[model samples]
Target: METDMTKGKPMEIIIRFAIPMFIGNLFQQFYNVVDTIIVGRFVGKEALAAVGSSFAIMTFVTSILIGLSMGASALFSQFFGAKQYEELKKAISTSFIFIFIVSLVLTTITSLFMHQIIHGFQMPMETREYAADYLRFIFAGLIFTGVYNAFSFLLRAVGDSKSPLYFLILSAIINIVLDLVFTVMLNMEVTGVALATFIAQGISAVSCAVYTIKRMNFIKFKRKVILFDKKMFKTVASYSILTAVQQSASSFGMMMVQGLVNTFGATVMAAFATASKIDSFANIPMQDFGNAFSTYVAQNKGAGNIERIREGMRGVSKIIVAFSLGISILVFIFAPQLILIFVKKEAVDVIAVSVYYLRIVCVTYTLLGFLQMFYGFYRGLGEVNVSIILTFVSQVTRVLLAYGLAMTPLGFAGICLAIPIGWFLSDALGVIMYKKIMVEDSV
Candidate 1:
C-alpha cells in the first residue's frame, strides 16, 4: 500500500507536498491581510481596530470547523494509505454532513449571542462596535468556510494539496479586486471588507467542491452509500471535539489578550491587531509544513512505515528551522518598512511597537515550528488528547502570565511576552511528551 508520496526521498517528498500547501496557506493569509491593508488604509484606524478586535472571536467560531476537517484528514490519510478507499469515501461523506450541520448550528448560536460574547470580554465600546460588525458578517460565511475546509482537507489527505492552493490563489485575486471595488471605490468601509472576504471564501469553496466532485471518482456516492454511520460519526466527533477544545481554548486566550489590548486605547489595540495579521502571514510556511507532515505521518503510519515518518519529520524540522531563522532576520531588518505597508504615517509608532513584538516572537519561531509539527504528528497518529492537554496548558499559562504581567511594570510588553513564553513552554512539553510517549512506543 505504498503511496507515491512515501516512495520518494523524504526531503523531496515533504517539499513537493508542502510547497502547494504553503502557497495555498499564503493565499489564505493574503485574503485576510489584503482586507486588513485596505481597511486600515482607507477605512480609518478605528475601522481597522474593529476588524482586528474580531480576530479571536472569528477564530473561536472557525476553530470547530478546522478541527473537524483536521480530524477527517487524519482518518482519511490513514485509510488512504491503507488503501481503504471505501472507508475513505464514507469518512468524507460523513464529514461533509457533520460539518454542515454543526457549522450552521454553531454559526446561528454564535451570531445570536454575539453581543453578549463580545461584551463578556469587557472591551472598549468603540472597539466593541467594530468587532461586532466584523464578526456578524464573518459568522454568516462559516458554512462556506467549513464546507470548503472539509473538502480541502480531503483533497490534501489523498495527495491533492495543489488543487486547493490553485483555487485559493484564484479566490484571493478576486478578493483583492473586490476589496478595491467595495471599499476603495464604493467607500463601504468595514462592511465592504467583510463582504469581500465572504464572497471570496464562497467562491473558493464552490470551486474546490466542484473540482473534487468532478475529478475524484471516490467521492461520487450512491444514496445507500451516503447513509449515516454512527461509528464513523463518533470517531470523527471524538477527535474533532478535542481538537476544537484545544483551538477554542487558545482563541479564548487570544480574546483575553485582545481585551488587554483594548484597555490600552484604540491606537495600541489597532497596532496589536494589525501586527497579529502580519504575524499570521509570516508563520504560514511553517504552518504549511506542519500540515504536510500531518498528512505524511498519517499516511505512512497507516502503511506501517514508522522509519519513513521519522525521516520525513527530520527533514521538515531542518527546513522549518532554516526558514524561521531566515524570515526572522529579514523581518528584523525591515520591521519599519513592513509596518508601513499596512498602516499610516501617523500610526508609525503603533506599527513600530507591533513590529517589535513580531521580532521578539520571531526569535522563537524554530521552537514554535517544532511545537506545531509535533502537534500535527500527534493528531495524525490519533493521539489527540495529548495535543489537547498541551494546548490547554499553553493557553492557560499565557492568559495568566499576560494578565499578571500586564498588571505589573511590563504593561503591553507583558502581553507580548506571553506569546513567546507560552510557545517555549508548550514546545518543551510537546518534545517531552513525544519522546516519552510516541518515540518510546514506536521504538
Candidate 2:
C-alpha cells in the first residue's frame, strides 16, 4: 500500500515506516552474520578472513547499485508526494532501465576479472585464493542484487516498506537454509555461503519483481511511458552519478583499510572482520532509521512542507542521541561476548583485538548516527553534492589516517581509531552545510 507521508505527523510517519524497514534490513544483514558464524566456526579462521576480504570487494561493486537506487528513491518519493503521476511513472521506468544496464555491465566486468580484482586489494596469501573463490561465486548474483535493491528502495520511497520486509524474510530464510546445507552438511566452506547468498538474491529479485508487477499498479509503466524522458533522465542522473561515486569511494576506502588490516596478518584480518560485522549489525537499526527519515523529508520536500521537514529533523535528533548512546553502551559491554561468537575460545589474540575495536569504535556511534542522519537529510533535500562532499572528505581522511597511523605504534588500533574520527569530522561538516542550506533557503 502506498503511504501519503506528506499527510502524517512527521515523527509518527517516520517511525511507522522505519519499524518495518529496520526489521527488513536487520534480516538482510543477518545473511552476513550467519555466513560469518557458519564459516568462522565450521570452516576456519582462514575462511572467515577470506570471506571478510571478499565482502569488502563485493561491497564496492554493490555500492554503485545502492547509490543509484538511493537516487531513484529520492526522485520517486518526491514525484509521488507532489502528485505528479506522469513524472513518477516515467522516472520509475527510467531509473529501472538505467540500473539494470549498470548491473549487467558490472556483473560482466567483475566476473571476468574476479581474480585480478581480489588480488588488487593485496589480501594475504593465506586468504587470497579463498577470497577469489568466494567473490567468483558471489559476483554471479550482481544483477539480482541490483534489481532487488532498486525495487526495494523504490517500494520504500512510496511508503511500502512492509512488502520488502516480507520478500527479504523469505530470501533470508532461503540463504540460511542453504548456508547450513552447503557449508555445514556438504562442507563447501566460504564458496558455499557465497552461492547461498547468490541464490537468495535471485529469489529476492524474482519475488520483488513478481510482487511489484502484480500489486504495485501505481509504479507500473505503460509502453509509451517506458521510453526515456529527457527531463526525467536529467533529474535522475543529477542525483545518481555523484552519489554513486561517493558511495563507491566510501567502500573503496574500506577496501583500503582492509588492505592495511591484511598486512597485520590473518589474526588481525579475522579480528577486523569479526569486529566489523558485529559493529555493522549493531548499527543497522539507526542506519535504517536514517533511511526512513530521508524518505519522510523527501516526501515533504515534494509537498513543499518545509515546517514538517524541520519537525522531522528535530525529532530525529532526539532519537539519534538516545538511540546512539543506548546502542553504544550495549555494544561496548557485550564486545567480548560478541567476538567469542565468531571465534574459538582458544583464539585469545583475535578475541582481544576484536573486542578492542568494538569498545573504542562503539563510543563513536553518536557521531556516526548523526552523520547518517545528515546524509539522509541532504539526500532528501536533493542536495546530493553536499552528501558527496561530506562522504569524500570523511573517506579520504579515514584512508589517510588509516595509513599514517598504522605506520606508527598504534597498528591495528590506529585503523580502529580512524573510523570514529572520520565520522566526527563528517558530522561537523554536515552541521556546517546544513546551516548554510537553511540560511540560503530563508534568503
Candidate 3:
C-alpha cells in the first residue's frame, strides 16, 4: 500500500489517498463521540459537563504527542518518497525512542498538577471532582494514547492507511461496547468511561506495535544501527517542536474559551461541550482531507515534484468546498436534533444553548476547511514554522476575541462568533503564504 504519488494524475491520486484517511478519521472520532453520548444520556448533564470540561486539558496533551508524531511521519514520508531507506530506518528508530521518553515525562508532569490545572480553568465547583477523576485516569493512560498515535501516524506515512483504519475501527468498537457496559449497565459514570478508553487504547497500541515490528522493514529498531544521530534528531525535533507548539497553542486558546463558557454555569458548559463534540465531528472531512493532502505533499516534495503538489492542492480544495458546504447545510438545519442526540428533551436550556452555538459555528465550516488544507500543504512542504505561525495567529485572535466579546452584550454568542473570525483571519494569511510560495517556485 506504499503509494508513489509522484507518478499519477494528482487529483485522482489525492482523492484515492484521502478517502481511506477520511474514513479512518470518522472511526477515530468514536473515542470522544461514544463517551459523550453515553455519558450525556446515562449520567446526566453534570457528568457530560465534567467530561467535556476535561477535553481541553486532554487535547492540550494529545496535541503535543500527535504533533511530534506528525513531524516524524512527514520525515518518514519524505525519505520514503525519496527512496532513502537506510536513513529512513535510522530516523524511525530514533523518533520512537525520543517520543517514548517525552511521553513519560509529560504523563508525570500532567498527573502531578492535575488538580491545579483543573482549578485554574475555574471549572464549576459541582463538576470539578468528576473532571479531576476523569483526567487522572486519562493521564495514567497517556502512554497508550501517545504510542497508538505514533504507530498509527507512522503507518500512514508509509501509505498503509488501511492498516491503521482497521485497527482504529476495532478499538472504537471495543470502546463503545465498554461505554455501554460501564456507564449504562454498571453505572460507573465518568470513572467507567475513562477506564474503558484506557483499556481499548492499550489494546490498540499493543496490537499496532506488534504488527509494525513484524511488517515494516524500515521501522525495525536494531540497537546497533539505531544509535542517535545529532543531525537527524535535530531535523525531527525542529519539525516536531513547532507543530507541538502550534497544536498546544490552539488547545490552550480553546481552554481559554472553555473558561469563558464555564462562567455561565453548568448549563452553558454542557451546551458548549455537546456542541464542541458535534463540531469536532463536523470538522472531520476538513481534518481528514488536510491529513491526506499533507502526506501527499510530503511525498511529492521529497520526489521534487512541484507541479504535482500544486495539482493536488487544487484537487483537494474542490473536495473541501463540497464537503464543507454539504455538512454545513445538514448541521445548520438539524442543530436542535443534533443536540438532542446527547441531551434529553427535558434539558431545554442545554439544547437551546447547544443549538445556538452550533448554528453560529457550523455555517463557517467552509472557512475552517480552507484553513486546514492550507496548513496541511505548508506542513507537507516541511514549512512547519509557517504552520506554527498560522496556529499562533489563529489562537491569539480567538483568545483575545473570546475574552473581549464575552463581556459584551452578545455574551456567549460573542464567544461563538470568535471561532470563525479566527478561522477567516488565519485562512486569509494561509492563502497569502501559499500563493507566495507557489509564485516563488514559478519564478
Candidate 4:
C-alpha cells in the first residue's frame, strides 16, 4: 500500500508511517543487542569487548549502506509523490545495480584488510583475535548488508514500511536462533554471532527483494530500467557521496573515540560497549521518526506541499521531545539493570562506569533526536551538501571533545560529556540551517 503523504493530515500520516519504521528499527537493533548479550553472558567480558570494539569499523561499513539508502529513499519519495512512475522504476533499478557494484568493491577491500583494520583500531591485545574474527565474517557478508538495506530503504521510500518490518521481524528471529545454536550449542563465540547475522540478513534481503519487485507494479524491473542510466546515476551519486562522506566521517570519529576507550582497559571498554547498546535502544524511536519525517518531507516537497512539510516537522518535534523525556527517565532508573542484560556477573567498576555514562547521555536524547530530524528534512529537500557540512562539524566536535575531555580531570566523565555536547551543537546548527534553507526556498 503506497501512501500519498502529501494529501493527508500531516500528523496522522506521519505518525502512522513512522510507527512501522520505529518497530522495524527496534527489531533491527535486536541484531546487535542480542549479539552483545549472548557474547557477554556466555562467552565473557573479553568476548564482549571484542564485539564492542568492532563497533566503529562495522559502523564505517554500515554508514555507507545508510548513506546509499537515504539517497534511494529521498529520490524515490520524490518521484513517487510526483507520480513519475517510469522514472521511479529507473531510479530503483539504478540503485540496486549501483549498490551491487559498490558492495563488491568494499567487500573485497575490507576482507583483505580485516586484521589490519582491527589492529588499527588499537583493539586491546587480549581481545584482538576475537575482534578480527568477527569483523572478517561480517566484512565477507557486506553484500548481504547492502542488499537488505537497499530493499528496505526502497520499500520505505515508496510508503511500504510494513513490508520491511515484516522482513526484519523474521530476520531477528533467525538471528536469535542462530546466535543460540552457534554460541551456546557449538561454542562459536563472536564468530557465531557474526555468521548468524550474515545469514539472517541475507535471507531477508533475497526474500524481500523478490517479494517487493514482484508485488509492487511501480518497483518492477525491466531490462531497460536495470540498464545504467547516466542521469539517474549522477542524481543518486550526488546524494550518496555527500551522505556517505558525512556518515563515514562520523563513524571514523567514533572509531577514534573507541581507540581512546580501548586505552582505558577492557573494563572501561566493556562499559562503553554495553552503554552503547543501551543507548542505541533508547534512541531507536527518535532515529526512526527522523527517517519517517524525511520521507514525508521528500514526498511533499515533490508534490509542492511546503506547508505539509512544515507541519510534519513540527509534529515530529513534539514526538521527539515527549519520547526523549520518557526514555531518559526510564534509562536513568534502570541503567544498572540494563547493563546486567549484557553480562552474567557485572564487574562493579564496569557497572558504575556504564551507569554514569548512560546518565550523562540519556538526558540529552532530545537534542540528538532534533538533530537527526533536521538532517532528515534537509536531505529530503536535496540540500544534502549542507547536511554533510553540519554532520562533519558535529563529528569533529565530538572527536576533539572526546580527546580534550579524556585528558582533563573530567577524564571518562569528559568522554561522556562529549556526546551530549556534540548533540547540542549539531541540533543548534541544524535548526539554523533548516531556517536558512526554508527562507531561501520560500522566496
Please, what is the whole-model Cα lDDT of each candidate in the order they appear? 0.81, 0.86, 0.86, 0.85
Clashes of each: 0, 0, 0, 0
Q: How well is each residue in 300-403 modelled by candidate 1, as lDDT tens digits?
A: 88788888888887898899898988888887788778888889878867876788788777777777687778778788878888888778777888888988
Candidate 3 per-residue lDDT over residues 197-234, each given as its tens digit? 88888888899888877778644556587666777889
Across residues 1-443, which tens digit of lDDT does each residue of candidate 4 receive?
Answer: 78888887887887898899889888988877899889988898898899988876898888887788777779989998898988887788887888888888899999988878887788789999888878887888889888888888888888888999999999999999999999999999899999998898888889988887786865556665577788888988877767777778778888888899999999999999999989888878888888888889899888998877888888889988998899999999999998888876547888889999999999888888888788788888878887887788778889899999899999999888888888888888887877776776571
Candidate 4 ranges with C-alpha deviation above 4 Å: none
Listed in order, each prediction's TM-score against the native is 0.96, 0.98, 0.97, 0.97
Error of 3 at 380 (Å): 0.7
Supply candidate 3's per-residue lDDT for 299: 91
Pairing residues by index, what is the TM-score of model 4? 0.97
- Model 2: what TM-score? 0.98
Q: If the candidates were sorted by their lDDT against the true structure, best first, what order would they fall in?
A: 2, 3, 4, 1
Clashing pairs in 1: none
The sequence of per-residue lDDT tens digits that candidate 2 reaches over residues 181-255 is 998999888889988998998999999988876787755566777776777889999887767887898888998
Point out the higher-scoring one by TM-score: 1 or 2. Answer: 2
